[model samples]
Target chain A: MAEIIGGYFTSHVPAIGGAIQRGDQQTPYWKPFFDGFPRVHEWLAKTQPDVAVVFSNDHGLNFFLDKMPTFAVGAAAEYQNEDEGWGLPLYKPFKGHPELSWHVIEQLVADEFDPVTCQEMLVDHAISIPMELAYPSVAEWPVRLVPIGINTVQHPLPSAKRCLALGRSVHKALASWPGAERVVVIGTGGLSHQLDGERAGFMNPEYDRFCLDHLASDPDALTRQSIHEMVRLAGTQGVEVLNWIAARGALGPAAREIHRNYHLPISNTAAATVLLEPACGVWALRRRSPRP
Target chain B: MPTPPRPGARPEPIPGTTLFDGDAARKGYHLNAMCYSFNRKENREAFLADEEAYCRRFHLTAEQRRAVAKRDVLGMIAAGGNIYYLAKLAGIFGLNVQDVGAMQTGRTVEAFRQFLLDQAKGA
Candidate 1:
């Protein structure tokens, strides 16, 4: 069976792409944000995951309001990134794990979580920027990809509970897949920053830290708040933390924090990255126990 | 301590924020559709060549056209624009997030950048 290694949560601001394009990682304005990733790099080096299942929200690159899926999974042979009209350099296509994707799709349906399965998909900065941050300057990515998109753009979004359920279902699917691949689950976007309305520059470090702490120690506590409350506390766009919550859910009931970094104002957003390792024995034991 | 919110009650309005609910989606569909076209380089170039013509192709509302013409970020939002799509339109004019932030907040670009930096002190 495929082994689920852990979960990585990070922000996916498009400006990070431009900062990389202009070689600004060492500059003071960007150094703090860039500093968060080296430890992530070290962890990736140690774990050596063969596949990455990414949870991120689309920012008008792949799906628009025409037909938005609450949850979508990519089963394409290759996922491409294109110009989002933001002038970030296009990244090379990422190879996909179709067999695993189909397995996940099948499991999701069986688990009663219907997700749109796309044989062709275009990933925007949400996926591309994080991939660049993870495997910088790679001509070809090292790991096969699985892109899962959660709708955060429009209102009437799937509830926080629903997103968590989606992640748990994904965890179940990965555990049952008949493969030897080592998998790392990645959730991208938000620590809190709003970029629309008069609240264009909103950032709540208090809420961000609370979320980071709870995400690692008590993710269910984070979900107790309603979507409206989340938007209010985190900000309009900051609600992308739903992706992070879903990613954490994939780690199962218990996870140990490997490393975490949080910084303010990465292009009008609070930026953060966290590495979580599932507590293998505890999780396995809990799974074996009967439901309450 | 604040009182706990009633379940299913309408959330308190967030000041200076607008939720992109279904109403906004319906109102801004054409405008957002036009901005979405900017994802293609040719569409961006065409919009740049004749802003009026491009806006017409999408059948944007008069208010949306005015907002686009004035480069009013806040006005666009009021006209039902979602920031994600409006960002692409902003890109056509070489406006980064900071620029748009400054524009919406009525601050100079440098001031807005400083405000963002100031957020760290509280963190």
Candidate 2:
């Protein structure tokens, strides 16, 4: 059976990608945000998971209002990043894991999550930034990408409970796959920052920190939160916290927090990074040397 | 089949705001698509070179085109503009999302900044 190794959660702020493009990672404004990823790099180098199931919301890249899929999974062999109309540099193609992606999609539907499966999807900064931060590769992405886009753009989005249920379904699917592959699931975007309305430039370090703390030990509380509650307290766009809830659900209740980092006011958003390892005995090998 | 909402049901509107739901998305389709085009540098240049022609090419409504021409952030929002895409239109005027937010709230940029500061401090 396939093994679910662990999960990671991080912010997908485009400006962090901009910082890397400008070689501004060392600058004072960016140093803290950039510093959060080295341990992620170290972990990736050590585990070298075969596939990464990335959970991120689109910002009008692939699905516009024409036919938005509240939950969509990408099953393409490659995903190209497009310019988000703000001059953010597009990176190289992210190699995809179509077979695994299709399997997960089939299982998710069977498990009643009902995601729209896309054969072609042009991912934006929400998909690219976290990959760049964790892998920082110009050649090819370190792991095969499985892009799962959840709707944070439109309202009446999947509730936190629904997001968590989707993640749990994904976890179940990964555990049952008839393969020896290792996988790491990632949820990207948000730690309480809004980009529109009078509340623009909103950053709630307290809310963000509270989220991180609970994500480590009590994700259910966060999962119980409604989109309105999240927006009311965390700001409108801060509703992207649903991504983190999904990732937490995949990690399961017994996962241990491997590492976490939070930084405020990074490009009009509060940025964060969290790594969790499943406590299942199947993952014991991850702590030892890499298998040949 | 899914359970239907009770007859005559309507969601309570978030005060002083447009929700940008599927209905709003349908209304703003052409408008947001036009704004999405501004992601490319040449597209931004084209729109800047001839705003009317650009809106025409994108088939924006009179309301959307007017909103674009006048740089009315709130009006744009009311016309179904998603804030993310609207940021591109705002960018053409050297305005950040915060600046657009100020316009939406009918507050000066300085006041908007102070409002954000107060919110952050309180949390």
Best by lDDT: 1
Q: Going through the candidates in order, what fraction of the true interface contacts does each contain?
A: 0.84, 0.42
Which has the greatest DockQ?
1
Q: Give DockQ for candidates 1 onward, in order.
A: 0.71, 0.42
Single out the weakest 10-residue window by summed lDDT for candidate 2 chain A. Answer: A280-289
TM-score of chain A of each: 0.96, 0.93
Per-residue CA lDDT of candidate 1, range B5-111, in tens?
Answer: 85545567889998998888999999999988888999998998998998999999999999999999999999999899999999888888999999999999999
lDDT of 2 at B81: 88
| lDDT (10s digit) by residue, model 2, range A180-212 | 888888999998877665446667787787888
Candidate 2, CAPRI quality class derived from DockQ: acceptable
Model 2: DockQ vs. true structure:
0.42
Cα lDDT of model 1 by residue, A134-223, tens digit = 888878988999999999999878888889889988888888887999999999999799998878889999999888888867888888
After aligning candidate 1 to the native by TM-score, how far in Å is the CA of A105 from where it should be? 1.3
